[model samples]
Target chain A: LAKTTQPISMDSYEGQEVNITCSHNNIATNDYITWYQQFPSQGPRFIIQGYKTKVTNEVASLFIPADRKSSTLSLPRVSLSDTAVYYCLVGAGRGSNDYKLSFGAGTTVTVRA
Target chain B: EAGVAQSPRYKIIEKRQSVAFWCNPISGHATLYWYQQILGQGPKLLIQFQNNGVVDDSQLPKDRFSAERLKGVDSTLKIQPAKLEDSAVYLCASSEPQGGGGNTIYFGEGSWLTVV
Candidate 1:
């Protein structure tokens, strides 16, 4: 499994844009980058995922460069509700595309109004 | 659709006691996962199951923890002789694999356990 590195914590004001980056210098070729958001006392929820290039959805966006060594999760118009711990996960591929995931200490985003 | 369901939202047990948590995955989800999340840290995968078969349990403390998915639908995880460090949230998640194994997995609210 590729080890991921993320900032321990980040702070943002309301209506700001928060971008959290993760570095996986040894990410595998078949591995995919995924992000999950977890609020206090709840389970982690899937935010976004990407292999390379940029992927966007209603909630957030994920950007992966050519090297695939790093990725960033961009959240637009942050609010207090956006306060949560964000996890960047690298899922290794098995014989098939399916595989297990292990998470590290995530980046805690504090959105203040 | 109904999301993953879990029972006994919270549990409190003393050291050397036993406790169990139950989970029901979303309809037709083939993969089920058990994760332990200590406060202020990300969740760690304890075990993964695919249709009543164990896919991985490398991180599971088999000496004290065991999980079984019967009929490939509902599952249960039990902890024997719980210790203080075992106090954390036990989460159950399930997913239907998408192409390239990137499908979003849904998690239940979690079973809060406090082992004193």
Candidate 2:
């Protein structure tokens, strides 16, 4: 399990773009970067995942540098509904049963209306 | 398809009492995990099971906590002589078998427990 460090909290207004960076200096070669969003009273939901470079989906984009020591999650046009705690996890690639997934304190993003 | 299912959405018990939580994973998911989340903190993995076999339980408090997944379908987690610190949300999650590109794990609404 790779330890990850991220901001404790971030503030953003509607229609603004929010970027949260996570540092995993000890990330392994087989590890993948994944981001999850968790709203109050609900479980964390998968937002995006990537091995390297950049990966985009309907909700967000993940940008991983060539070194893969850190990654960024970017959300475009934020709204109040997007307010939640976002977790960044670094774990082995798919099908690796030995991987032990862990979670950090996570970055809480408060989207203001 | 339905998501993970957990029962006893809320539970309140006195210290030294016993409590149990049940979980039903998504229809074909082979991997199941139990996590504990304290207020203002991230979730901690307590146990993980792959098709009724224990995968990882190094974080689980073996003395007071025990879990089992019979028949590899439904699972149960039990806490005996619960302490105040045991008061937290118990979350159940499941993911597909190892392999393929998508190994995304899905979680269920957690079961909130309060130890008085």
Candidate 3:
């Protein structure tokens, strides 16, 4: 499993953009970068995933540099409802039998109204 | 599209007692996982099962914790002689068989356990 490091907490106001970066210097070639959002008393929800470059969805965008050592999650027009813990996970492969997706402490984003 | 289902949403037991949690994964999901989440910490994987076979369980405390996925659909995690430190949320998750790119794992609401 590739270890990931991210900020412990971040603060943002409504209509502002929030960016959280995760460092996975030891990420493997077969690994993919994935992010999840977890609200209190609920399960973590998939936000976005990418192997390289950039990928965007209805929820957020993932930006991975060419080195692949780190990745960033960008959220646009934040609202109070977006306040939650964001987890960055590495080491998920394509069709590989090994399923050891590990999570770190996660970055807690507090969106203020 | 039913998502993962877990029962006994909340449980409280005395130390040295026994408790169990049940989980039913989404339809057609071949992989099931059990995770323990402590307050103010990230969830830790306890076990993973592929269909009806065990895939990974290195983090599981075999002396008192055990989980089984029977018929490749539903699973049960049991803890015997629970200790005070066992107070945490037990989460059940499932994902489809990895085919290409990345597989997305889905989680349930989790079962909260308090060992007094």
Candidate 4:
């Protein structure tokens, strides 16, 4: 499993854009970047995943550069409901018995008024 | 489609006390996982099960933790004598078989445990 590093916390106001970057310099070719979001009492939900370049979902966008060493998660038009802890993980493409995923201390994003 | 289901939404126990959590994965999902999430930290994998067999458990504290998936559908995780540091939320998650886009995992609302 590839180790990942991300910010501890970030803050943003309503309707603003929030971007969180994760660094996985030792990422392997088979590793993919996945992000999860956790609200107060809910389980962490999958946000977006990307192998390279960029991938956008209904909720967020993932931007990866050519090096594959880093990736950024962008949330547009943020709302207070978006306040949550976001985790960035690097792992082998899912469902492989060898893919033992690990989660690092995530970035807690606070979207205030 | 139904999501993963877990029981005992919350638990409070003393140090050295035992506790257990249960989970039922989505129908037909073959991969299940147990994770521990301490306050203010990310969820950490404790064990993984492929069907009724264990796949990974290196991170699980064998001295206190044991888990089983019977019939490859429902699973149970038990701590024989939880410590103060064992106070954390136990999460149950399941994923479908590997597909083109990588199987995305779905998590159940965790079982929160507090040891005093």
| Candidate 2 residue-wise lDDT at A8 | 100
Per-candidate RMSD vs. true structure? 1.6, 1.2, 0.9, 1.2
Model 2: per-residue Cα lDDT over B7-106, one tens digit each: 8999999999999999999998888999999999999999999999999999999999999999998999999989999999999999873465436778
Candidate with more favorable, higher lDDT: 2 or 3: 3
Q: Say which candidate scores most in TM-score.
A: 3
Steric clash pairs (candidate 4): none
Those runs of model 1 whose alpha carbons end farther than 4 Å from true positions after fitting are A93-97
Note the residue pairs that clash in candidate 2.
none
Q: Which lDDT value does model 2 have at B89?
A: 94
The best candidate in terms of DockQ:
3
What lDDT tens digits, residue by residue, belong to model 1 across residues A8-98? Answer: 9999999999999999999998888989999988898989988889999999999999999999999999999999999999886433425
- The better candidate by DockQ, 3 or 4, is 3
The TM-score between candidate 4 and the true structure equals: 0.96
Candidate 3 clash pair list: none
Candidate 1 CAPRI assessment class: medium
In model 2, the runs with Cα more than 4 Å from the true position are B97-102
Candidates ranked by TM-score: 3, 2, 4, 1
**Candidate 4 residue-wise lDDT, B1-116, digit = tens:** 99999999999999999999999998999889999999888899999999999999999999999999999999999998989999999999998746765567889999999999
Cα lDDT for residue A49, candidate 4: 86
In candidate 3, position B75 carries an lDDT of 100
Fnat values, candidates in order = 0.48, 0.60, 0.68, 0.63
Full candidate order by lDDT, most accurate first: 3, 2, 4, 1
lDDT of 4 by residue, A21-111 (tens): 9999999988888999999888989899888999998999999999999999999999999999999988878456556568999999999
